[model samples]
Target: MYKLSPFTYTFAGRSKAKKIFLDSTLIFERNDTVAIIGPSGGGKSTFLKILKGIIPEYSSGKLEGEVLFNGHPLSGVYFQENLQKILYLFQNPFSQLIYPGTEEEFLFSMENFNFTREQMDREKEKFEKLFNLKNIWGKKTSELSNGECQKLVLASMLAIGPDVLLLDEPTAFLDPTARKEFYQYLDVIRKDRLLIIVDHHVDEIRPLINKVIFVDHDGHITPGFFTKNNFVVEDISLPKPKTAEEVNVTVSDLSFSYHKDRELLKEANATFKSGEVVAVRGRNGEGKSTFFKLLSGILKPKKGQILLEKNGKTYKNDKIFPHVGFVFQNPEAHFFFDTIEEELKQSFRFLSKEHTVLKDDLLSRFFHDIDLKKSPFLLSEGEKRRLSILMTVFLEKSLILYDEPTFGQDQKSIEEIIVLIRELKKLGLIQVFISHDDYLIEKIADRVLVLEAGRLYEVPRA
Candidate 1:
C-alpha cells in the first residue's frame, strides 16, 4: 500500500517558481489499477515521478508532505529496501533501455536483484513468451522499432516481479493490434499488483481500469469513474482539393532495407496530390517511418526513384530537400536552438529573406500557453510536439511529412492540430502523415494508404 498526504511539488521558473502539485492527496492499495488523465503539460508525468520519489532526489524542486510505503515513510533505508518492489517505466523506452542488446538488458535487470542464473533464465523465458519478444532477443536496442522498445522495457520490468508498476503511456507508439495484445497481457499480469497508468487512450483501457483520476491545469487531483463517454471524437472537415489530378510527389519502384535479410520496403509506389491530407497506416515496424524518411530525403532508396513535381519541374530524391519538411516521431530530436523562441525564429529565417517574417503575435497564438523563453529540451512531450510541428509549418514546404503527429497530445491539442491541417490544405500544400489514430485518419485524411507486405495500397476514407 502507498499513501500521499497533502503532497506539494514546485519547479524553478523565470518570474517565479511554478507549483506542479498543489497539496494533493492520493492513496493506492495493493490491487488498484488506476488511470491518470489530464491535458497536455498538465503535470501527470510529474505526479508519477513524485510518487516514485524521483522529484526530490534526482530533480531540483520544492517538496512537502509525506509519501509512505506500507505505513512507513519513504527515506534512505526504506527506499533502498523497497527499491525492487516498486518499478517506474518512463514514457520513452529509450531512457530505460540502457544496454546495447536485448538479452543483456533483460539479464542485467534480473541480476540486479540477485537472481541466480537458473532463475534469471526462467524469468527471461517467461517474459519473452508473455511479451512475444523472442524475435528481437538478439537485436540491438537502437535498431528496434518504437513498439518493440516499449515491449522490451515492459518485459524487463515485469521480470523482476515488482509489487507496484507505474507505466507512462505504455502503448503510445504501438499499432492497434499490438496495443490490444499488450493490454490483454497487462490485464492478466497486474491482478495482484498495484498498477498506475498515465495515458491519453482512456477509451481503450476503460475496461481494465478500476478508478480514474483527473489532473487539471491547476494541479488539482479529482477522483472519478471510468466511462466510455469520457472521449468524444468529432469528425474534422478538410478543405477541398484545388486540382484532384495534380500529383505533388510520386514514388516509383522504391526499395529499402535496414538489414540484408529483411526488406522493409520493396518496389513500393505511391502518389500524393496537392491540397490533400494523405494518411499512411500500417502495423508496427511495417516501414511507415521508413517511407517518411525516404520521402524527406533522410534515407535514400536502394533501387527506384522518388520524384517531386512542382511548377512543371521534376526533382529527384536527393534534390527534393528544398520542397520537403519532416517532423520526426520524437520531437525532441528536431530541436537545435537554445530556446523555443529561437527555434521558431530560425525556421522563419530559413524560409524568407525579406520583411515578410512571421510575427510574434501569430506564433503566440499557435503556442497559446507555452513559455517562449524556456529551452526546447525542458518542455513536456506534447509541448515539444507542438513546437516541432510549428517549425515545420513555418517553412511552407510544398510537401510535409509528419510521423505520429498525435502521440502524447490531449483532446484540445489534437483539435488544434486538425484545424492547422485544414488551414494547410487550403493553402494547396501536400500533407502526408503516419498515424495510428483512427479518429484522426477518418476525420482529416482525404486518402488513406495502407502499407502491407512491402506495397502501398489505397483504402477508401471512412
Candidate 2:
C-alpha cells in the first residue's frame, strides 16, 4: 500500500523562480488499478515521478509531503528494501534502458533480483513471445525503433514481477494490435498487483480501469467516473487547396539495410504530392521510421535516389535538407537550444519573409501555457512534443515529416495538432507522418500507406 498526505511539489524555474507542479493527496492500495487523465503538462507525469521517489533524487524540485510505503514513512532504507517490488517505467524508453543490446537490457532487471540463469532465460522467452521482441533480441539499443524500444522496456519490467508497476504513456508508440496485446498481458498481471497508468488513450483501457483520477492545470485533483457515452471525437475537415497535383518528393529504387544479412527496405518507390497528408502505418520494425529518415536526409539510401521538387527544380536528398523538416519521435532529439524561445528563433531564421508573421502567432498559440525562458529539456513529454512541432512549423519547409505526432497528447492537444496538419495541407505543403492512431489517420490523412515486404502499399480507403 502507498499513501501521500497533503502532498505538494514546486519545480525550481529560471532565475530562482518556482512554479507549483502538483498539490494533491492520493492513495493506492494493493490490487488497485488507477488511470491518470488530464491535459498536456497538467502534472500527470510529475505526480508519478513524485510517487516513485524520482523528483528529489534525479530532478531539482521542492517537496512538502509525507509519502508512506507499506504504512510507514518512505526513507532511504525503506525505499531500498522494496525497490525491486516497485517499478517505474518512464515515458521515454531511452531514458530508462541502459544496456547495449535488447537481450541484455531485458535481463538486467531480472538479474538484479537474483534470478537463476535458467529462470532468466525462461522469463526472457516468455516476454519475447508476449511482446514479439524475439526478432530484436540481438539489436542494439540505438538501432531499435521507438515502438520497439517501448516494447522492450515493458517486457523487461514485466519480467521483474513487481508488486507495483507505474507506467507513464506505455502504449504511446505501439500499433493497434500491439496495444491490445499489451493490455492483455497487463490484465493478467494486474489481478494480484497494483497498476498505475498515465496515458492519453483512455478509451482503449476503459474496460480495464476501475477508477479515474483527473489532474487539472491548476495543480488540483478530483475523482472522476469513466463512461463510454461521454467519449466525444470531433471530425476534422480542411479546405481544398488551389493546386494538389504538384509533385513534392519522389523516392526511386530506394534500398537500405542496417545489417549485411537483413534488408529493411529494397527498391521501394513512392511519390508524394503537395497539399496532401500521408499517413504511414505498419507493424514494429517495418521501416516506417527509416523511410521518414531517408526522406528527411537523416539516413542515405544504400542504393537509389530521393528527389525533392519545388519551384520547377529538383534537388537531391542530401541537398534538400534545408527544404525538409522532420519532427523526430523523441522530441528531445530535435531540440538543440538552451531555452524554448531560442529554439523557435532558430527556426524563424529559416522562414521566408512572407511567413515571418507566423513566428509570433505560433508562439502565442502553441506556447501560451509554457514559459518561454524555461529550458526545453525540462518540460514534460507532451510539452516537449508541442514545442518541437511548433519549431518545425516555424522553419516553413516545403515537406514536413512527423513521427508519432500524437504520442502522449491529450484530447484537446490532439485536436489542435489535427487542425495544424489540416492548415498545412491547405497551404500546399506536403505532410507525411508516421502514427498508430487510427482516428488521426482516418480524419486527416488523404492516403494511408503500409510497409510490407520491404515495400510500400496503399491501403484502400473504406
Candidate 3:
C-alpha cells in the first residue's frame, strides 16, 4: 500500500517555475489496480516520479510533504531496502534499455539484484513465453521497434516480480493486437499486486482498473471515478494550397532489410495521391517505421526507388526532403532547440509571407495554453508529441509522414489532430501516417495500407 499526505511539486522552468501537484493527498491499497488520466503536461508523470522518489532525488524539483509505502517513508533508502519490490517503467522504454542485446537487457536488472543464474534463467524463460519475445531473442535493442522495446522493459520489470509496478503509458507504442494481448495478460497477473498505470487510452484500461485518478492541467488532482467531457476540439480554418499542382508519391519495387538473413520489406509498392490521408498499419517490428525511413531517405532501399511527382516534375531519393515533412515516432530525439518557442521559430523559416497570418492563428490556437518558454524536454510525453506534429505540419510539404501521431494523446488532443489532418488533406498534401490508433484512421483516412509478409497491400476501410 502507498500513501501521500499533502504533497506538492514544482519544476524550475526557463522563465518561471511550473507547479504540477499542489497540496494533493492520495492513497493506494494493496492489490489495487489504478489508472491515472490527464491532459498533456498535466503532471501525471510527475506524480509517478514523486511516488518513486525520483522527484528532488534523481531530478531537481521543489517538494513538500511525504510519500509512504506501507506506513514507512518511500525515499532513497526504500529503493535499496525493498529488494526491487517497487519498479517504475518510464514512458520512453528505450531510455531504460541499457544493454545492447535484447536478452542482455532482459537479464540486466535481475543480475544487478543478485539473482542466481538459475533463477534469472527461469524468470527470463517465463517472461519470454508470456510476451512472445522468442522471435527477437538474439536481436539488438536498437534494432527493435518502440513497441518491442516497451515489451522488453515491461517483461524485465515483471521478471523481477515487483510488489508495486508503476507503468507510464506502457502500451503507447504497441499495435492493437499486441495491446489487447498485453492487457489480457495484465488482467491475469495484476491480482494481488499493486499496479498503477498512467495512460491516455482510458477506454482500453477501463475494465482492468478499479480506481481512477484525474490530474487536470491546472495542478488539481482528484481521485475517483469522475467523468470529464467539457473540453471540446475547436475547428481552425487553414488556407488552401498556393498552387493547384497535383502531387503524389510512388514507391516502386521497394526492398529493404536491416540484416541479410531476414527481409523486412520486399518489392513493396504503394502510391499516395494529393488531397488524401493514407494510413499504414502493421504489427510491431514489421518494418512500418523502416518503410517510413526508406520513404524519407533516412535509409536506402536494397532494390527500388521512391519517387515524388508534382507539378510536371519528379524528385527522387534525398532530393525529396524539401517537399516532405516527417514527424518522428520519438519526438524528443528530433527536437534540436532548447525551448518550444525556438523550435517553432526554426519551422517558421519554411513558411511563406502569405501564410504569416495563418501561422499566427495556429500559434494562438495550438500553444495558447502552453508556455513557450519552457524547454520542450521539460514537457510531458503527450505535449512533446503534439508539438512535434505541429512543427512538422508547419512545413506544408507536398508529402507528410507521421509515425504514431496519436501515440500518447488524450481524446481532445487526438480530436484536434484529426481536425488538423483533415485540413491538410484539403490543402492537397499527400499525407501518409503510420498509427496503431484505429479511431484516428477511421476518422480521417481516405485509404489504408497494410504492411505484411514483406509487401504492401491496400485494405478497404471498415
Candidate 4:
C-alpha cells in the first residue's frame, strides 16, 4: 500500500531561520518505523511538529517545512482530505482530549474518519483486547490519568487506521512497566504503516526502531540505522545545575491527613538541602503531592510543621511560594487565561509594579527566552510543561519544588527539563523533584528519598 514519489520534509526551530533535520531528507515507503534520537534541545519535538503540521502553519519560529501525503504536498491539503489517514500523539496526552464527553464520541470520531459501523461495533473489543482498554470504555477522557488517556488515544488511533502514525515521546513519563506495554503497541503498528517517533530512551526501544534519525544539541539531525557513528553527540553533556551544600528545607515530624481519613501522610521527617537535587519517590496515593502542597503553602499540614530556611529566616510552609517557586503537576489547574502572554503578565501581578524591572528581568529567564507569544494553551503538552518550569524560574525563587514533571512528557521534553533543572540549580535554586524515575534520581538528585507507605528514607546511600 506504499505510494511512490518522495516522502521528504524540512523544518527549523527558534527565531533563527536555519533549517535542521535529524534525517534531513527521508525517503520511505509504507511500513517503515523510524526513531529520531538526539541530545536535549536538538529539535526532536520540532521535527514532529513539522510532520504534524503544527510547524510552518500553527507552529512558530519561522517555519520552512513541507510535508507531503501520497506524493501530494500538504500546503493546501486540508485535514478533512486525510483526517482518517493521520493521527499525531503529542507528548502530553492530557490536553489532546478535545471531543465531547464519553468514549462513544471517541468512537464516533473514528467513524468520521471513515471507520465502518461494523468497525465501530467491534472497535472497543478489538482495541481493548489489543491495548487493554476494557475499563476505559465508559470513562470520560478527562478522568483518565496520563497513562490511561495515552492508552485510549493509542487505541483510538489504531481503531481509526491512520496511514502514518507519529508518536512524540509517548513513553517518556511512563514507569518501567508502563513503558514496556507502550512499546508493544508501537511494535504492533510498525508492521503496517509509516511510524515516525521522536524519543531518547532508544536504548530500551532499540529493537522497535527500524531506522534512527539523530539530532545533535545544535539542531543538526543525522538519520540512519543505529551505528557507532549515529550515537555521536559531542554537545550532549550533563549540566551541573546545583551544588552540594547545606539543607534548605526542614520537615520536622510533618503529618497530614485529608478530613478524617487514615492519615494519608504520617510523621514525614525530611530535610531538603542545597548543592543537591533531592528526589521524592513513592507509589501513587502516598500523599506525595500533598506534602508538596504543604511545602508550597497550597495545603496546610494538620499536625506537624514544615519550614523553609532562606537567608537565615525560617518561613512557614504556608508562605513558601512567595519566597520559593513551586510548579504544580497540573499547571492547567491554576490557569484562567486563554493566552500565554496573559498568563505570564497576570502571574507577574503577584509582585508589585515597583518590581516591574525585576519582573521583565525574570521573564527573560523562561527557557524559551525568545518568542513566547504563541497560543500558550494551544502549544504542545511538552511545551506547556517546559513553560511551567520556566515560569517558576521567572519567579526567581530561592527554592523550587517540581511534582511529577515527567508525568506526561515525551523523551525530548523530559531531556530539556532535565537540562533546565540543572541550569536553574546551578544558579543557586534549591529544587525538590518528586517522581518515581530511577534514572532521573541518579542523573539529577544528589540525594534520593524513597517513601514507603508514609515514611521517608533517612539513610544516604551511594
Per TM-score, the best of the predicted structures is 3
TM-score head-to-head 2 vs 3, winner? 3
Work out the TM-score per prediction: 0.91, 0.93, 0.96, 0.67
Clashing pairs in 4: 22-221, 241-422, 241-425, 241-426, 243-275, 244-275, 245-275, 247-273
| lDDT per residue (tens digit) for residues 21-80 in model 4 | 433455656788888766444567776766655655564445434456676654345545
| Model 3 regions lying over 4 Å from their true place | 22-24, 226-231
Q: Pick the candidate with the highest lDDT.
A: 3
**Residue 94 in model 4: lDDT:** 71
Off by over 4 Å in 4: 1-25, 39-43, 49-67, 75-78, 99-108, 111-145, 215-222, 225-276, 282-291, 300-317, 328-391, 394-398, 404-430, 450-462
Task: Return the TM-score for candidate 1, rounded to 2 decimals.
Answer: 0.91
Q: Mind giving the per-residue lDDT tens digits that candidate 3 earns over 1-462?
A: 888787777676436666766466788987789998877677888888877767766776778777788887766776567548789989989889899999999999999989999999899888888778987899999999999999999998898888888899999999888899999988988988989999877778889998888888776678858465546777877766567659988899999887899999999999988798999999888999999988988787899999999998999877888788899999997688878889989888888666767776666555436778778888888888888888898776888999999887777778888888888788888899999888888999999999998999999998
User: Of models 1 and 4, which has the larger lDDT?
Assistant: 1
**Candidate 4 lDDT (Cα, whole model)?**
0.64
lDDT of 2: 0.82
Predicted candidate 2 versus true structure: per-residue lDDT over 1-462, tens digit per residue = 887777667777556344444355677888889998877777888877777777655676777778777876554666677678888989999898889988899999988889999999899889878999878978999999988999999888888788899999999999889999999888888888999999878887888898788777665666766643333434333334355535578999999999998999989889899888999889988999999989988789999999999878889978878788899999998888889878878887887676675566655555435678889998889989988898888777889999999998877777778878888787788999999998889889999989987898889754
lDDT of 3 at 5: 80
